[model samples]
Target chain A: MYTSIAGSVARPSEVRLQSPRPSIPPSTAQPEPVGSAFADLTVCRHSVTMSDPRAAIVPAPAAARATDVAIELLAEMGQDFAGSRSIGETLRRALHRIVDHLDAAGGALFLLEDDGRTLLCTASVGATNIEGIRVPVDRGIVGRSVRSGRGELVGDVRTDPEFFQAVDERTGFVTRSILSAPMSVRDERLGAIELVNKRGEDPHFTPEDLRILEAMAASAALAIVNARLAAALVEQERVRRELELAAEIQRSLLPTPPRAGFPVVGINVPADVVSGDFYDFFELADGRILFNLGDVAGKGMNAALLMAKTASLFRCLGKTVHRPGALLARIDAEIAETATRGMFVTMVAGILNPATGEICFANAGHEPPLLHRDNGTFQAFPADHPPLGIAEGSADTPLPEATVHLDGGTFYVVSDGVTEGLTVGGAPLGVEGLQDILREAGRLPPAERLTAVTSVLTAGPRPLHDDATVLAVVGGSAVTRPRSGSAAGRREPASEELVRVSVPSCADRLRLLRQVVALSATQSGCCQEAADELVLAVDEACQNIIRHAYHGDPTGQIELSVHHQGRDLIVLLRDYAPPVDVSRIKPRDLGDLRPGGLGTHLIRALTNRAEFLPTPPGGGTLLKLVKRIR
Target chain B: MNTGMTHRVERRQTGMVVVALEGDVDLQSSPEARRVLLDAVAHGGAVVVDLSKVGYIDSSGIASLVEALQKARQGGSRLVLAAVSDAAMRVLQLARLDRVFVIHPSLEAAITGDR
Candidate 1:
């Protein structure tokens, strides 16, 4: 009876599974006792016999047998799947179990591709190197089952119009019957599971077989979803760490606030983890301060990197180019050669002379900075050329510069984020709004004024969409006049008769020493030439202590005292550094042609008498410089 | 007044390039001064850097001038410093580089290769 059943379903040249021995091979078979729960799960062979007349009619016992086999197969698959290390491995094991349990000739598991228009065969059983085969998502019976989220059972390829024969033609296999089910987790269809050519006498698949295959597919789908989610989470974590590092590097690149008496303050706030805005204020060796504000074209890591590079270039070039227009031209040429296409920088650079209240500024496609005059009015100096990195070569027209006298006034530079910030009503705070804010806070000092503007701009609950940067330069108080005026032309004595200060031996403090010396010399009735020479002598003495006696150690303290004697103006400098070798302190030969070791020479040349003596009750150096008051 | 340092390069009728540098050549202004001086050296002719207006110079400024001197030698040309300011000359004397280069009292003297 079984022989006739097997012969009736066999095709001309199709590989058949030899069955009726045990359902699963002994190597993979599990022990089952008689009358156990899985006893009804004996492999069913379709045949015409006294007890069963129709081969396709699944009776109550046959239905029970299919359910029992599906349950046992699933239990075993769960264990093996849990032990699998990779997604491919899990899918491979699942496909093997499905083909073995259903007694099908072969099976393949197809997964959705990233494009979502095609399915790639990720794992396959009974096929040699057929992995990575791709088929259109809507092309075959497998595609139909995936689309409908249902199982398809086709008894014969010739009778089923939806059956796609291309796979068979490609793989050189003949298809007799097929059972395919969509693998879906919740509402998302991941892919499809397809089994082909049921083996033994049961070439035709029953509805019961389709039901069992569907249950297996559901389990496989759940595993696939879990793996993909794990992968996505890892990728997210990696990106987060990279952004954190980028933010740290950006923060380190920001410049520190300028010292007191510099009349400059700057602030920056990023809209995201990193900002593309930067500002800097540093004093040049010529007593002029160089200040700048810049904004890169975009946000995030790329923008942050470009901002750092642009700022560094400005700092290095700013030291060389005193004219703001010439500096911008050089920066533009450098950016054009090094910056990526489509990326550029908008910047405003200027040099401020505090004593004379003179400022020379150049703008490059940036927002016009507002110059608040002492007369309660503001003027905007707009860009004269495009932003840097956008054009090749130097600007056609000389980068126009605006010279403004900033006595008792302020200069403000802001990024676009200030004007484009949204309010509660979703309206942008235009440039006029920014001007109003500045005007209201104009009464406050430069640093406090910057704080007031920031609070108002970022007050709304809605976060800013970009980086906001503000730089302000306020003019110094009207105290020191230009050194060009001769002291003999003055009508009044200096404001102070005596001045003394104790400060750390640092290069930055030399300016303070010069101020005190100039005051004392003027009060003593010394002419401008004599007073200037007195100040230079004292400055050179302090520099020697800072550089030579202290070896550039800022922790060392220097005491400066300036006073007028009966016929001599005297300046005394004392430091607690190691005692100097007075014998070896002679100035270098003037005929020698090199740099350095000039502090002693300048001090001696400018002062009537410069004497180096030891401090009382201590091991330190005390320098006394004097000039006759005529 | 424009107190900031400035430079200009001129080609003399005698085929010598004269780079006139004005202002203080300290740490802040050495880079620009370097560029101007080096360009004169690269032009491959007798170069004279006129420092008549330079009132001050630091070690960094001297280093730039030395670089110009080296470049002039590599290009097989003469480099001379003219009208050296007292302040700048003192620094050059201290560093002992004053003996290395040809020094002249004025631009005309440098152009004529006078001592």
Candidate 2:
């Protein structure tokens, strides 16, 4: 028991009772050193429980006879020995009570520290400032009482060698009788409360003295024990409050639900009191949407920290990054340079068309997301590259792009926890189990369907080992698809210096303009105007290239480059061909006011700007026509 | 060319001087073009930047030539760009540098009697 003077914050008289009787009390006229003996005497304002009023209800001792009357003499002092109620005055009052009860010259209370190895005399009276005398556990008569777990009674301590003479040497007090008992409650020992010299002016302590002081030791132990329990309860409550506050802040950082216009849905769940899985969804400047999900390597507090850091880094990169493959490459390079070793994250991010339904996605060694077809079939689209934080640069791992139509079909995505869940009988709920569940649950509402499937998968003996999270998107539709056709239509400028453009928006404008712009300077009229026409034609043609030929997804370039060879506005249009057939157009059909399939008609109406050219590298369908305006 | 800092700027006539800069005329040290040409043109002279000594150049290095031309014009003087560095020439060619700045054959040929 560490009995700390965690003592009441008060002056020496109010806080501790070190000198019961002053053999050399400090002079009222003189000053004392800052700390000669009182350095270890602590004074703290502690909130201790006051003594209960009901404690006064005690049975009176049996009637004292003649020899017993002598025994009753010590009991008479018992009235003064009653313990003091806790306050700054407790130590002072308790010391006076013990001096009267034991019929002694004086008494002292020494408190131990948190560790039982050291003691500091906490309270004293009579002898002046013994304010703080340090004593070790195995040193003197007080120590002997603690070690032997009993009282010590001795007569004439000046002859006794176990008696520490340093106190007598310092205080000049006579040492004749000593009665000490270990102050303890149950198994805990605080320190010793000892009475010195007989008050009736006797020289030695009797056996009756030992019994009297032991009673006082019992009362002292109870007071110290109660204060300790109060301190511990307050500390435990403080720690619990701090943990609850920390957990609340962590919960607020999770991803918000998607907005009305986005085509994806994402979800994340942490297994413990906190989790590290995170997801974010937002839009890019070009009307394309960006969404990502990342699973951190570990769980609990460490995992949550990494999850937050990863989200912040992703947002900074995602803003400047546009293409899905290019974005992933930059992200991988950044994480590889900064991520801590042996700890990495797996992630998948993608861009989607809220209007056209085109999607580009990149995965870094994450679980292959499952795509469910409208007809109840599913395909596992696995990642072609290693996980993030493994390597840097686009060349490190060739992450491939897989495109699929998502019109009227739902895509089911999840962490590995779903596929790896097992039944009570030790069989895994593999892909087959998932497909079977999806087929049955497909008819139900999407949110409810998820709840029903997760329950069955996570039921019984071998359920999920970690937190399970699943995100499902029920959609499949695209607008404005690409088509190819062949045509033999050409337009020639009627004048001497004018160059004409035929079907300028037909994926071959750059090729046509480069040829015409080069030849325009040598022509008879308006060189800059001709060059300007060719530039505009090139712009329109590139737009057509993206909309046509490549089926609205051109991953390569169209060649419209050409050089001048004098007066001829010789324009050349080159591409790998699916040539548009101009003969199929009915001139009378334009009267019907139909909007689409007018590719050549629009090109013809926009420009006699340059000659149509045919310069396909394969030697097929290259349109080369020249016009001169003068 | 009696070169100074790996280059030379010799006044061949009253109205013109041929400043030939050598080595990589990059952003760090293209200021020699402005210092030498501006000083020569202040005396009511014209100039020609002989690029025969230059090994390379970029856009910031190009600004010195434009400043020289602007100062020569303010003095009612003329300036001509002479044979450019092959590496520097290629960057100029890509941005159609031939359209904006005049090209000459040699320092002596362009500045010889232009005053």
Q: What stretches of model 2 exceed 4 Å from their correct place?
A: A1-240, A259-262, A285-287, A322-343, A356-359, A365-368, A373-409, A416-439, A453-465, A478-630, B1-115
Cα lDDT tens digits, model 2, A454-528, are 676556565356555666655432111111132211122222333444432332233334445546543445365
Candidate 2 lDDT at A154 equals: 76
lDDT of 1 by residue, A369-459 (tens): 9987653458888898899999886633346788998755688999998778775567777878777666556545467667766666678
lDDT of all the models against the reference? 0.74, 0.55
Q: Which stretches of candidate 1 lie over 4 Å from their true place?
A: A1-69, A72-85, A114-116, A258-262, A300-302, A395-398, A443-445, A478-630, B1-115
Q: Using TM-score as the measure, which candidate wins?
A: 1
Could you tell me which 10 consecutive residues in candidate 1 chain A have the lowest summed lDDT?
A: A11-20
TM-scores for the candidates? 0.55, 0.41
Cand. 2 TM to true fold: 0.41
